[model samples]
Target chain A: MSHLHSLKRHLVARYGAIIAITVLLLEGLCMFAIRSYYVNTIEQVLSNRVQLTADYYQKYVPGVTPLARAQKLLSSVDKDEVALVEVLDLQGQPVLDSDGFIADYRHTTPEVSAALNGQQHAWVGKSPLTGEKILAVAAPLCRDESRDTVGVLRYSVSLEQTFRVIQRLYIYCLLVGLIVIALVLALCYSLACRILLPIEDLTIAAKRLGAGAHDVRVRQRSQDELGQLAATFNYMSSQLDAAERAKNEFLSSISHELRTPLTSIKGWSETLFSGKLVDKPNQTQLGLEIICEETDRMIGLVEDLLDYSRLQVGHITLSLETVEINDLVTEVYQQLTIRLSERHIGLTLDLQQQLPLVEADDDRLKQVLLILLDNALKFTPPDGLISIRTRFEQDIVITVADTGPGIAPEDLPFIKNKFYKGNSKLPGSGLGLSIAQNIVQLHKGRLEIASPATGGTTVDICLPQSTPWTAGTYNWTSKANSTRQNLS
Target chain B: MAKVLVLDDEIRIRGFIVVNLESNGFEVVEAASGEEALRIAHTQPDIQIALLDIMLPGIDGIEVCRELRQSYPAMGIIMLTAKEQEQDKVSGLEAGADDYVVKPFSPNELIARVNALLRRVTLVEQVSSSSEELICDPFVLCVSEYKLYKGEKSIAMTPTELAVMEVLLKRSGKAVSRDELLDAVWGPDYFGDPKIVDVNIRRIRRKIEDDPSRPFYIETVWGHGYRWHGESLA
Candidate 1:
């Protein structure tokens, strides 16, 4: 019933009354045509029968017969041999009855009325009293030397046989029509729903997947269009899940990196403060220096986190200044000298003399360089050559190259992603490149990472050439050294 | 000889300042707080310099500096600060203090700054007292080097203790205290107490006095006061 209500809603929109009226009109026309044909054929047969009776009378009886006599003659004829024969007087009294009906000549049927009006008529309907189906036709008969209104002669053939034949034909046609309609409806419903179901399922499953439930899978039960859509959804979910897993792993590794340095600083500072190194000046100084360096490293990591977050939220405000790239590189190199020396990495400078000052933050640029140089030193073998080169290609290009183990081609694409490290071949916090890239981006600069032909990795920082200088780049190491020299 | 007073809570720091000042040829006096420095400044008028530490146990250095500067305009005052934060240094300088040096500072730097302050104060004092031949605290003298020209009676003294007496007689217009005598004659850290300070007074009195026991060239300041008994040079 609810389905019917919905269907009614659809049918109403496409003109329900017009469709019903058209169906009713077509049914009425069919009934009219069938009745007309039934009457015409019956009238033809009746007229021929009447004419044959007239011929028989004319040939066998060589004298003129009165109307009453003709009526008697017609009535006397064998009823079983005749389909239906009836005579009515001009005063409307039945003269002869056939098919065992006591005919009331005063009563007028449509066929009789038409016949009395000098037009022949016939009709098909159920019999009222006799309960036998019949087709009736009527016409006026005239007799005598002068034409006069005589009586009506009516004929009706038993229509039971025609009715049976038509009934059977209609039943067969209706059965075939119903079967065809049923097949069409079945095919339409299956085709429409078959095409629609998987799309529906895909939409539902995709919605669930979007809500972050990875276990949702579309059923690919067919080799049809919707099945292909389901397959695509499955592939997308799998890809998303893989990427999510990789991100989780990267976050875990970052946490480990953050915690390890923190643990070392905490543990060693406690040991140092406990006076275990009271007599050991060298050890005490080493411990203090290590604690200071580790604290700096932790602060750097936190700063990287802040920068990354700022970059993610697009909130970084660059304090741009005209900077000498070579000077900046030298500052970072000096700061990292202890580590670089320990790694036995010989830094060769190829700075362009009188290179145009590029617009950048000297400190932030130094930070970026430190991260990159630290990474290079970490991955480079002892006694490997590290080189700093500056070039101008419409902009300042500062490159730090080292003879370290080169990065794999696949890892290069993801090397700048947060906390993404290459398979732990070398130990790293994995934030160096990512932070460097973010800082470079903040300066409206470009960072390109590539493997040198000989070996190791090269990072190129390209900065714009026309930003303003807001402050001087003061190297703390140089200041301390100068103070020491002055004191000495 | 110029008299200097050192005020520091730390014994080692006080010794360090006193030793440096004495080596630079200034007569040095030591006090550990603003109160002691104030008390010493009130009685011993010969103090030429007052070095104060900004952080002190009681009556902080700035207050002592202000009081000393008010009482003795010729006295040089230096404030010592520990932190390099500009606020501390500026506060010390703004408190009527002469100069400030950050602590953990080099001893040479402190001495250099002290000597520079002394010269600036001395030069200003020289301009104000241009006609005065010698400027010393008011005190009486009985020494061999100079005759008392106060109405023409020449005072006499022995050469052995005469040099000691001369240091006091130069400041005869003011009270010549015991520590000043001890610092000039026997040297700093003389270990002997106020007795040697009294004994030196007795020895100077015997040669230059009319009576040894009741001599009145340099009068004893019992408890909290001292005076020159002969006469005022003015």
Candidate 2:
């Protein structure tokens, strides 16, 4: 669930950032284009009007003085269309002004000077009289049939109306762009959420599955890649649920089967040991030993099944403490030496001296060692050599090798599966290797089994010199400590 | 020899217990189911104790124990339970069983429990004949009746609790160690934990004392055992 929440947040942030940036860029470009187009159109209109007036003055004004021609043109032009109009002569002195004749007035504007030099020019400046921004254009007046510059004609228009139009255009474009951006953001948000909804569902279902709710499944809502993933998740959970049920059923039945015999055996043994069968000395002696051996076997089987079940359900806890590997090996060897002797098997121990103390669950590690030794005792023939060897490398490695008939290639792989009883003639529950492997794994160690065709089987257990502390390990240790305190 | 009713679904286990009980001088009656056990119990009026297996086909041992307690209030009941079904033992006790023995238990332990219960029965009979009731102020112990009265309210107790209270009331104002109480109640041959006495004492105090922790009648002699305050009511 937390994973799903974080994924939703990440998707929203990434898509939202992209959409916002794209909208901003597009709005900026549109505003610039609109402003430039409006300004350029106004400037072009003013320039064209100035040229047309100059041509009309040159053509229709019939041999009059330059001042008289300028006055006639200015009187004909509309004042609302053009703010200021002036006529200048070749000597850079103002010939006529729309405001009226002024004494010693000179038109020294850059556009007027450029026009007198036979160039058409446009300028934007603040009007000297009105103090408003204005666009001005100046055109050269030429003599008829000579094309020589005679006077300059200038026309200027206030830019306030044009600016107001541009401002309105800017606001309109921004409104449309904002609406489109909001729509796009909403679409993108919904699309992203729709795209991630199935994945989020799968994540939540997977969490439930991991927490042992095996029946949980994701709903496939669409025929997309995410839908396929959801389908796969559902299939996996169903498989897990089936496997769990099968295992539980197997364990329950096996426990019932194992306990029934154990109950009878233990009951009769206690009955006989309670001196009820004391009349026959020899028979009682043999019966007592048989009872003892069978009871031990039953106990071994029960412990193995319990250990496997605990490992399966993740209930196995370890009490970690420093342990000398050599000492531990020697102790296991001593505990099993009697059994090995009873089977008439020769034993050898090759342990390294002064081995370092490895952090592990001492009792669980010993259980692993005993399981290996017991297996070796069972498989090895009389007068066969059984070697218990230890090496101090990067890790502590302990190997129990037996001179027994090697496991068949076909049976080797399934040997560690619980209740996979290979060679039914061999009297054992087949949980030995699996339990040992689980115990070794709990200590952050590894167990390997190798059997050769030449009649030997070797089991190696490698344990790390030190294990890092984890939350799981801490919880197990604390639980173990509390149990110990209760016992004390 | 006391007549003991043994009920178990497993024939072999039932046979084993019957043999063990018979050899130990108890007259044993065997029944395979709750219905059969009830029938035998009703027909045999002399049945003094019952050993019931908790798991049965029709009615479980707990139900049978409850039914038997209603019918025969004086009959001693011991439940036989599997080791894993510990909850059954507590339910058995609540249903009026006096004690429980886990299955696959040693034959000697079973025999010892039966003998101890019958011994307590005989002791109660003897006490009733000697005295109707033993009174130690606000508390009254009717030995023959197997009941304790606090003020005017009578409180029913299990056989184990009754035995322990009887021993303490007999020697009121004197400290009796846990070992002495266990010997008197569970018997000298009882190989169980001595903590059994402490448990029964706590049960008795819960029933008769206003405050079990600061017990008014059953006072704890530190490091020794319990003593009953023997001041009589005016």
Q: What C-alpha lDDT values do all the predictions have?
A: 0.64, 0.77
Among all candidates shown, the one with the greatest lDDT? 2
Candidate 1 per-residue lDDT, tens place, A274-339, comes to 565577677667666766766786787677777777666655545556677878877777777776
What residue runs in model 2 are displaced by over 4 Å at the alpha carbon?
A: A1-13, A44-48, A90-94, A101-133, A142-148, A160-256, A277-488, B131-141, B148-156, B164-234
Ten-residue region with minimum lDDT total, candidate 1 chain A: A470-479
CAPRI grade of model 2: incorrect
User: Model 1, range B98-175, lDDT digits (tens) per residue?
Assistant: 556655555566666676556555544553344333323332332222222233454432221333555555556477
Task: Provide the RMSD of all predictions against the true structure, rounded to 1 decimal.
Answer: 30.4, 16.1
Using all chains and alpha carbons, the TM-scores for the candidates as numbered come to 0.50, 0.58
- Residue B77's lDDT in candidate 1: 68
| TM-score for chain A in each prediction | 0.69, 0.53
Report the lDDT of model 1 for residue A196. 60
Q: Give the per-residue lDDT digits (tens) of candidate 2, residues A1-488.
A: 57656777777777777877888798889888887787788778878788888888777766478777777878877776655777788866777777876437665667877998999998877766568878888899876767899888887778888888888988888888788778876887787778788877877787788888979988998888888888888899898998897577556445544554454466557767678657756645654565565578678777777778777766677777778888888898887788778878989999988776687787888888888887787778899989999998888899999998878889899788776656533446677788888888777789989998887999989887765554224534334445765698
* Strongest candidate by DockQ: 2
Q: Which RMSD does model 2 reach against the true structure?
A: 16.1
